[model samples]
Target: MADNLNADLSCPICIDFFTEPVSLECGHSFCRDCILNASRAQGEPTGSIACPQCRQNTARLAIRSNRLLANIVEGFQRLWQPQPAGSGATPAQCQLHQQELRLFCSEDLQLICRLCWSSDAHSQHSCTAIKSAYTACKANSIQLLQKKLNEYRDTHTATGLKISETLEHTNRLQEQMAAEFAELQHFLQQRERALVQRLRAVAESAVNQLVENMALISERCVLIEQALEEIQSTQEQTQFLREIKGILQRCDLQTKPALKTPELHLGEFNGPLQYTVWKQMLNIISPAPVPLTLDSESASLDLVLSKDQTMVKGRSKLKEFSHHAKRFSNYGCVLAREGFTTGKHYWEVNVESIDEWIIGAVKESIDRHSAFALTPSNGLWTLRKWNGNIYGPHHATESECCQNMNLQKVGVCVDYEGGQVSFYNADDMTHLYTSTDRFTEKIYPFFLPFPETMTKGVLKLFHLQL
Candidate 1:
């Protein structure tokens, strides 16, 4: 029992048996402070009192007291001290309640004496064998803390990766935007240069047009000044002519009394005065020349009329017609026909009788001249000279003259007064189309000659085909 008591008694610093006690780096020791202090003071700093066990230099700072270790040491010392006899086994007591405890399990987190288990505070709490609940609660708490720490570390790692990816994507997009902006700026500069060039060209053209117009005006002014000078010289010559006429009259009266009254010879008044006056008047009255400044580069030819033969009319007498080239003979005989001409033909006539002239292409010569008063009817008036054309003929089955005749027959009839031209299938007198615009001015018509007959004479005697 004495040996057991000695084994439990421990040093305050090392918390073990006090067998070779040595001081620590903190200067607290059992039996080695003298040798350690002596060794430390001999070398390095004179006041260096480093402990031999912990190797701490105790010269700079004071040693701190180990309260927990001191308390445990004091408790162990009290337990080793002598006690009175007949002390019955003192029950373990709870520090909080000051009551004797019958059970305690350090491993199970439970401290329940019989009295505590019966109390309301500990009735629902888990209670195990002595010292078991405390160990279990500590182990469970450590596991829970470790799980939470691992989860926080994983979350932080994932967030860091996402931030890095987003930063990389932002950097790429910024670079792309900068490159696109540079290309756009280059394109805009090129367009600006082209526009400036075009504007300069337009300005130069405008200046050139202005210069041309001014030059034309200057030439016109010079012509006007020349005209004015001519007119002034003509006026001076007219004044001289008047003075000479007065002198001639005085000589005639004075010489009449002298003899066989010499006749006053009035020489012809031909002079530059008359010519200058005439030229100046002509310059003032003549029409200015028209500028044919058409920009032919842009002209189009979509609606131009095709060139055909010209036609002219005779005035009155048949003898007067002989002066023109003998083109064709108008055989004085009129036909009651209406159709388009296939080949080119020309003829003219003077109306000797006042008859209703149904000149345009029609199905038949109807006696209904009253219905022809309308503008676009069967019987159209010839208000002015006109030219017409007939397309190729195909079939004709209507009129009697074209019932079974050759189908390749067409005719074109022109009228001057009515402003009308018509096309027809001459075999059946079937009118096809008509036009209203006329050619009133004189024009020579074209004619295709037949090889069968060449007889030609005045209007009294001429050749006929049908």
Candidate 2:
């Protein structure tokens, strides 16, 4: 009974017991200050105020104070004290009117008593039972939490897989390092043994030559001694004199410069030891070039690929190939099967005097259906040979002219992490051009054997020493 009376005494605007209560012409009442504030918020220019409960406009801002309602609210306030939580004897009540909070205002997102819901402030606002609002809001919160939980679980699983992959890669890399070191050791041992053997052979040959010279000198000495003794015994002067001339001539011939000891040719061993070894090791230890082949799926319709996929050429008749999203539709181009996202890679192409050809590295995301110049801006870091004698790096506005060198083979080296694509004359590994640009995605080897004008040139792919 107290709750019912308290509700009747409360002002709808403030959801509290009326203070200085005032009634509008519509017979519904509100605190005088509350109604004035609401009127100013409405900003009506007619000098009229709208009743908070009925929305009826009054001609003047005449708010008549209700002494009866104010007196009742004062008495209610004197008797009402906030009910404590968990006090099993009494229910929770509004602080102002001491009425039970029954409904939730959807707009204000707060609890309100029955009278507060019917008040002018909330008459136009939607209200729902507290239990219904709690159930709906809790379901939404749980749904969001569940979605995040699933996402976190998926991330955890993916991280585990990545960890496993890293371990496998690490093991493989260690094994490769061990194998390479063993091979290097073997090469060094073989070289050392060969050098020692060669040195020993040289020493033995020199000793043998000296021994032969010594034996001849000993023989000459014996002959001269015999001749001297024969002269000394001189029983017959003429025989002695005849033998002396021959002996003298023989001595001169034998003594004529004993062969100089053969000089030992140290050859390469006499030079810088580490430098010589390094020079020799280059032939055996150069990095193996990246193996690349034309991707038939990415070839233009007018291009023909060889059976091994290592060579490509242009053909007038369109090939009967399947429609692929990556196929070059508007350009006579093809990409290698392999794409690189990291590390340095090198591959060679034999253009073989192709009048219209392009060789380079292109981003994997380049447009396939639209035509664009093979330029850096277009994701193609390429060198082109056109009109049979002209060579240049392709650009959108104009090709940067390069001195024609009749380049037949081109080497493309892409350092993905370094963001550089270098072109070389494959015949001598001469640097032809290098394009330095930012790379954020996978890059593929690009090739265009022949343009639309002539369709008979071929380009070949091969691995070479870098």
Q: Give the candidate number with the greatest lDDT.
A: 2
What is the lDDT for 256 in model 1? 24
lDDT of each residue in 1-466, candidate 1, tens digit only: 7445434444432223343344445655542333333454346465565554566677533444445555554666467644557876575787766754644433345565544543556545555433334466678789989999999999999999989988987898799668766755665565456645756676566667667667765665565565455444555776756665554453343332211222212231224544444454333321211111111111112111112211112222333222222222331111222122232232332211211112322222322213223233433322211112222221122211222222233344555544545545544557655556444343222222211121321111011221
After superposing candidate 1, which stretches have Cα over 4 Å from the reference?
A: 1-140, 176-200, 222-235, 238-466
Q: Give the local distance difference test score of model 1.
A: 0.40
Residue 218, candidate 2: alpha-carbon lDDT: 82
TM-score of each: 0.25, 0.46
What lDDT does each candidate get? 0.40, 0.77
The sequence of per-residue lDDT tens digits that candidate 2 reaches over residues 1-466 is 9767767776677555676899988889987766776777677556788876788987664768899888878878667755466776655677766777866787887888765765667868877656556787678668989999999999999999999999997998799888888888888888889987887888899889988888877887887787777678877878877787876675575545466578687665576777677667766663546768789999989888899999887786765777899999988889999998988788888877476777888898999998777678888888777655434455422544455567778888998876889888888998877888999999999987765755566778885433
Give residue 380's lDDT in candidate 1 (0 to 100).
31
Total backbone clashes of candidate 1, pairs 3 or more residues apart or in separate chains: 42
